[model samples]
Target chain A: MDMKEFKLNYYEKLYLARHFEDELMKLFADNKVVGWIHSNKGHEVIGVSLALAMKSHDYIVPHHRDRPAYLAKGLSAKSLLAEIMGKTTGCCGGIGGELHIMDVETRIYGPTGVLGSNLPIALGIAYANKLAGNDHVVVCNFGEGGSNRGSFHEVLNMAALWSLPIVFVCENNKFVEFTPMQKHMNIEDVARRASGYDIEGIIADAFNPMETYETFKYAIEKARRGDGPTLVEAKTYRLDGHYEGDPMKYRDEEEKKYWLERDPIIGFKASLLNESIANESELESLEASVHQVLKEAVEFALKSEPLKVSDTFKNVYA
Target chain B: MTKINFRWAITHALDEELARDDKVFLVGQDVGESGGVFGLTRGLYEKYGGWRVKDTPISEEGITGLAVGAGMIGHRPVVEIMYMDFISLAIEQLANQAAKTFYVSGGKIKVPMVVRTLAGGGFKAGIHHSQSLESWFTHIPGLKVVYPSTPYDVKGLLKSSIRDDNPVVFIEHKGLFSLKGEVPDEEYTIPLGKADIKREGSDVTIISYGKSVHQSLEAAEALAEEGICAEVIDLRTLVPLDKETILKSVEKTNRAMVVYEATKESGFGAEVSSIISEELIYDLDAPVRRIAGAFTPIPLGDAEDAHFPTVEEIIKVAKEMCY
Candidate 1:
């Protein structure tokens, strides 16, 4: 928990995530990606920082918006981009696009389209880990909308009662689509809801990469040591609309400006500068390098062979 | 071979799976101390304890989703839906998420789980509680649907379903829970796609399954008194249907009568009739006859008896074909 290297790695990963989201924005505008796309643009620190803290054996069930967390955990950009193209070469083939990309090998499962469904599933995965003597944790990610779904209560009740080893990362981005959290239900912090389940709850600044990492580390360490589930609410913002094409006319101009000013990527960069841990030249060089990875990923995705229509019969069994 | 009720056969399957592998576990509304609604999972909680035999919340969607997710990690989860009618609430999770997980992952993950529930209208539980919707599940390509009628089929097929790497919908009929039949004590499995022949004859082929299999047997017995021979074929698993056996029987008899307890309109019997007409069209002597429940909500209490096809109705249809 006290390791400084882990904090540095988290910051670096979040930087990569921010760049990935930025590239995806251009791709969406160009129509290079098909179907709908959700972004982790404003919440990069929470997504990448948490993934950086998780052990290889630990599993992650990320909602649709956590692209950085998924790619950071293990999924290759080529496969992820191929999926965006709806090509057979994509991970999970063309059937699962942006919202459903998953790498089962690394346990970064479910870029689940359905909001709250992953809560129980993540709890179940953690239950499996506990039974198998894995001592590994399951990191669950969901946005503010998920807090209202029935799955949230069912999973929380069971997870608390069973003492399952899970860390619920509720990224309170303040809005469910266009509806503000205040409109959905009356609660100051989503993390406080966990007190009803008799479990520990903590709130952290989603834009602060260091705080997000520390909060995730506490939950994961508690799970690894068999202290039961923890609810960690990362207060973040959604820089984009619910979907790529949404007009988002419901929001006031000022509300949009508030989130844009507090963009986690910029906040983290400022922190690195204030700490003198990273130089401006070093940051530019790292951005340049990550851009190359994305460029090669795009090329790899384009050059990749299309899945044949006849190949559909393969991979059902075994 | 052990003479076991359908309930005990299912219990035996669960007991066997739990004893053999540590990863296999069960959960449902009343599976634990309640011993399951129909007692299929009787004494499981006391035997395996809470970790394996879990009692879950009333949210069927959550139950199924968790089972699917847990299965991905490496657990063989057998979740029970209290009644087949309630499956409608969880179809989104079961059909979209669990059924398509493997194909969506391009073979990287597997949803190795079983959803067991009781279907059919014999209980006369009315429109809300009574339904035989296994055909709804069979429409999907990724899922494997099993409708087991006999104790032997229940024990064998459920064991195979739990061990299989894909999701399986194991539909049991509530009326057949107490029905006893000979089941082998030895561990065995009936392959997914194979069918069973309950009776042999040359006059006509009676294709039925689950609760309808018994109704077919009753109709066959009535036909025997009138000196007509009918071949009774019980399709234990509907998804990986034993079409080969049904077709072979239809070829010999040159006539087929498909029976089911579901609605007569576009019921599974209609699917069997289509399969027969498609495969053995030239060999047919008479048009394939289907006897099924009346196209109405299953009536409350015993009043549904008229809507539910009786042995007389089956015999009436069979005699019409015989002449």
Candidate 2:
């Protein structure tokens, strides 16, 4: 694809993710979708950039807040909505709700509800790739809060020791649920934890798609060449509450406004237009296309059948 | 048939399975060049190389998580968690990830892995080194729990557990590791969910597994001399429990008793007693008895001797139910 086409593609993905989260929140309010809805509004660029850099054969272990990662990894919006709504047509047949999203064909492993749990499992996938002599790299995504989990330290040490082909991407939104990063851990930068494991660490501006995409591409290439795992800390923010319906009393208005000004979708759209990659009319058309796709997805999810009683009993064994 | 120790039977089973399929591999601490803590993987590491017989750090959750991930991608990983006591460290991986993978993925993923851990008391290993936690895994659905008594059963059941497309927790008794039994020299396998009749009788039925099975067998012999004619049934697998065999034996004997090495409170014997009462209460002549350990942490040294149910206790239960 040409530069113009590539830039358009990335913008479309970012716009689609932003709109998807907006649509999901609206559905939650209307009672069409139930359960906790985590909107990944500001984390879209990191997920989209990582997806852009990853090969089709490579696998990804996404985070619970990474609906964007799931979409970029080929999970259909309709199925994601269906699963979130607890319908039978969901990707996991409604057994796994919003917290758990995976696509075996796309090699999207998991995002278990338990934080930092997916790290070790992602290492296993990387180990499997190494054992099979495949040059595929596994990308594991989690938040700064997850870095404090024992699983993070344990898995990083093992990954370095085994020289596994994997990348640990920590999206630092500066909050552990409701608490700020200052109260959660002693260190400010999560990338510094990588040095304790003897792995190279890199920090990138997650708001800049080009920087995030370039850093991921370099790390992924290093893993494919058997250079072992790399820890990439993408500094970003959460544009919405920890979960939908969360009262924002814990967060100050100043911090919220600060992050809102740097919203990934808006900044990326401006960049796309400034570079003359696309005109205003073209960008608006792309935005309209994304809105149309998500509208159809919501309708499909609403029309999908509810799970049967036997569906819960199925797949318990094999 | 050839006579072998329970430890060797386990080693031989792992050796054969590793050789049978290239996808089969072992992972755990000291599992590679140093064999295993109990010398279970002895010479296989040198033969299969370090990658196949992987030696890992003292990270229980990490290594088990690796096995789960590898198993999900079509690799058969056999993980040895030195002792059953350490299983608490890795329970998150086994119960949450390994057990639920196949089901939660909508049947798109399969975690074909086996966790081999040494269990039971009498080693004076105390609470940290010794435990009978089979009841924990049996409580979790989508997980197979196998506790074998003799060398023959351990060897056959282990092979089947490795080949089976599900996560299995294979518990080996530390006390019974040195016990000898006859096993076929040729290749063979025992299915998971079958109970073997160690001793046949007609009066009272005793159901046990692991180290308790041997105790029940000895008790049955003593009962036979006293004309009590007690029947001993060894349940090889706990999850896919052979309820039919248990009910049939209970019907014939008209009395039932369950024995295990774990503590009495909420132990596996309680489940067995409930099943017997729920299904065969009319056929039973007496209330089901449970012979088990006291509800206390295993003490140190010889103090742990009386911690487990003894052969005398089994005999007393059988005699009480009969007379």
Candidate 3:
């Protein structure tokens, strides 16, 4: 795609994610959603770029903050919204809710609530691909706080040791739940931990979609070439609270303002306009299109059937 | 039929399954080139080569999660956690990931994986190596817990577990590894959730599994000498427990005694006792008696003898229930 078209496409994804979260918050307030929705409002570019760069066969094991990744990976907003609303039409038939929504058809492995548990599970998918002689790679995403988990360390060493085709993407939004990055770990960069396993580590400014996309492309291609795993730390911020209802007492106003100024969507929008990649009319049209899509998604989710009691007991065994 | 040791029975099952299905692979610490710490996976590594019979680093959680992940995408992975005690390190993956994936995914993914681990007190392997922690897995739904006793049951059950489309926790008794029993020359597989009547009697039913099954059989023999007819039931599979066989035996015998190698509190035997009393309480002539290990952590080597339930203890429980 040309630079103009690429920027427009990136802008569309960013707006869709921002609007998705914005509408989701309203739904939560209206009590239409079940469980917590870890909003990926600011870090949209990190997951969206990775999804954009990923191939059809490549698997993505995304975390709670990666709802945008699912959208970018081609999961319909209708299915995703229905999943969050506990409707039968959801991705996992409403069994996984928002926290654990997964669609095997999209090659999307859902996350476990147990912090970094998906790292090793994603490694398994990569391992299976390698054994099958498939060049497909798995992009396993986690937060900086999740990097402190033993699953992170153990999975990295095993992936490197076996030379599995996998990429570990760390979205360093600083806070791990209520704890800050510095308080949780002494290291500033999660990618630096990759050196312990003798793997390549790269850092990218996730606020810039071009940089995030290029970084993921390099790491993903390197993994597909069977050179082993790479840790790509996407530097970003949690524009919203950790969860929907998290109190903002832990974060200072100045720090919040600093991250807010660099919010990826705003930065990308300014760049698109300043560079003349897209006109004001074009950007407004894209925003209107995203709003229309989300409106339909909400209607579809609201119209879908609610989950029955038998649904809970249906899949206990194969 | 040919008589073989329990360890070789397991090896034969793995070998046959690895040869029978291309999707079947073994990955665990020292399982490949090293032939496993117990030499159970010895010849298979040389036979199937490194890819199928792969060895792993000493990361129980990693390998267990690997098996679960691999199984989720159609690979039949049999991961061994050298000792059941080390399973504590991987319980999060086993219980949370492996056990729940099929259900959470609404049956779209089938985790056809087997976690084979050695558990029992006779190995003198200290608290970390010697533990009958089957009840911990039995408590988790979506996981099939199998504790086989005889060589025949091990070979058949291991083969069946590999073929099953769910996560199976196959716990082998370390004490029974050297014990020999007749296994058929022809290919055979014993289905899960089926209890075998090792010895039949009308007076009392002795419910047991794993190493305790052997003790229960011995106890039944002694009970026969003492004029107390005790029926010995070997619960080959613990999760999809053979409730029919247990209930039928207790109903016919009218008295039940549960014997197990695990601790007395909340052991798998307790589940069996509850099932018997819940379903066939009116048929039972006497209250169910439980003979199990001491509540303490398994002691070192020979000291495990005192902690583990002995044949005399089973006999005592059986006599108490029967008389």
Candidate 4:
């Protein structure tokens, strides 16, 4: 497809993901939601870019923070909202809550709540898919803090030894809960560590949709062809605190301004508008339509009920 | 049936499964060249080659978690934790992830993985090496824990565990690795949640599993000689435990004595005793007796034999129950 089509798909997905998390924050504030949430609002560009780089049949295993990835994978807004409301209409049928929105059929294996826990699982999926004679690639979306965890090292080494078809997309928003990246690790870019595994290492402008998408295209294609996994460090910012309510005092004032000025949504809008792909009016109308969709999803969740206690033990044996 | 050792029974099960299915494979430390610490996986690497029977670095958390995910996607991964005590490092993956994946999937997924490890207070494996934490695993709801005392149970249960669509913690007692018993020369599969009656009697029920089952049988023989008539029930599977056999024995004999090698504070024996107290309370003539290891860290391996419950202790408890 051409750049115009790519721009349309990526922008719509990025905007929807951003708007989705913003609504979730408000719902959480009103206590209209039952479970905890991790929003990836400003990290949308990276998630959208990575999604386009992957084939429809290729795997995308995301975490709680990658709301954009969830949307990119076409997990329904109604289902996500139902999950937050603990309704049976949710993915995993509300048993897994906000953190674990898995659809094994879609191959979006997880959004595991536990930190740095799903890397090996992703590797296993990639290994299985590769062994079955199909060239399916596995892309895992995690954070910078997860890169420092030993699971990252163990999985990377194991994946390298097996030459598995897995791509690790580290959307490094630069925080592990309350901890800063600088306090713990010496390295600036998480992707740079991939050299030790003898695989391709890259850094991308996570705010630039086209650049991020183009960078991942090569890696995803290579992995799908059984050329081994790539480490794509999408340097971005959360723009919000760890969860819905935390004071980001650790953030530098100028650094915050720098990222906000280069906010992924505004960056893409300006890029498209300057190129005359879509006017400001068109973008405004798109935003309005997305808001309506999200509103309907909120209504669906608000009108839902907590599943019965017997439902907890219903599917234990199957 | 022919004479075989515990380790050979393990190999036979692996051999049968490998020959039957291509998806089944083994992964663990020392499983390839050294053939496992107890030689349980001997000849598997040579027979299947490196890709199938692979040895891995000491990444217990990663290995077990990988097996969990692999099992989810139609691969039967049999991961071995070199020492049962080392399993503490991988508890999150084993207890939480593997056990919860199926239930969390709402039955859309299943983690068909088996974690084989040697546990118990023998072989001088040191404090960090030698320990019995079977109760901790049996306490979990979704997972099944299996402990086989004889070669027959090992071959049957190991084959069954590999084929079962659930996570099975197949624990082998270190003390019984070399113990000889009759194993069927042909293929056999022992179903989970079934108990075996090692000896029959009418006066009392002596209940146990793993190494302690042998001790219970020995005590039953001594009781038989004394004309006390103690029935011995070997609880092969700890979870989904065969309460039917134990309850039936209790209902007939009207008395029960539980035994194990784990600590007395809270061991597998505690669960069996509690079941007797809860389910067969009215049927019993006396409060059930539980014989287990002392509530202490297993001492040095030399003194470890004393730390575990013995036939002397079982016989003494059987005498008390007989009266």
Using lDDT, give the best candidate's number.
Answer: 2
Question: TM-score (0 to 1) of chain B, per candidate?
Answer: 0.97, 0.99, 0.98, 0.98
**Residue-wise lDDT of candidate 2 within B35-122, one digit each (tens)?**
8888999999999988899999999998899888888888999999999999998999999988898888778788999999999986
RMSD of 2: 1.0
What is the alpha-carbon lDDT of model 3 when measured against the actual structure?
A: 0.89
Tens digits of lDDT, candidate 4, B64-159? 887887788888889899888989867777787788887777677788889998888777756777887888788787889999899899889999
> How well is each residue in A1-318 modelled by candidate 3, as lDDT tens digits?
988887798788878888899989999999999888888877899878988889978899888899888898889899999999999899888888887877888888848898899988998888888889989999999999888888888899999999999999999998888777898788998889989999999999988889899999999999988888999999988877889999968888899898888887888899888998888998998899899999999999999998898779888889
Candidate topping DockQ: 2
What global local distance difference test value does model 1 have?
Answer: 0.83
lDDT of 1 by residue, B1-323 (tens): 87888889989999999999999999889899888777777788999998789888797887888888889877999999988889987786778878878877777888899999888877878987788888788888778989989999999899999999988999988889899999876779888878889999899999988888898898899899998899999888888788889988998999999888888898888899999999998999899998888988888999988887788888998888988
Q: What DockQ results for candidate 1?
A: 0.59
Error of 1 at B260 (Å): 1.1
Q: Which regions in candidate 3 have their CA more than 4 angstroms from the true location?
A: none
Ranking by TM-score: 2, 3, 4, 1
User: What lDDT does the true structure give each of the candidates?
Assistant: 0.83, 0.90, 0.89, 0.83
State the TM-score for model 4. Answer: 0.95
Instruction: List all candidate RMSDs to the true structure.
Output: 2.2, 1.0, 1.1, 2.0
Clashing pairs in 3: B124-B301
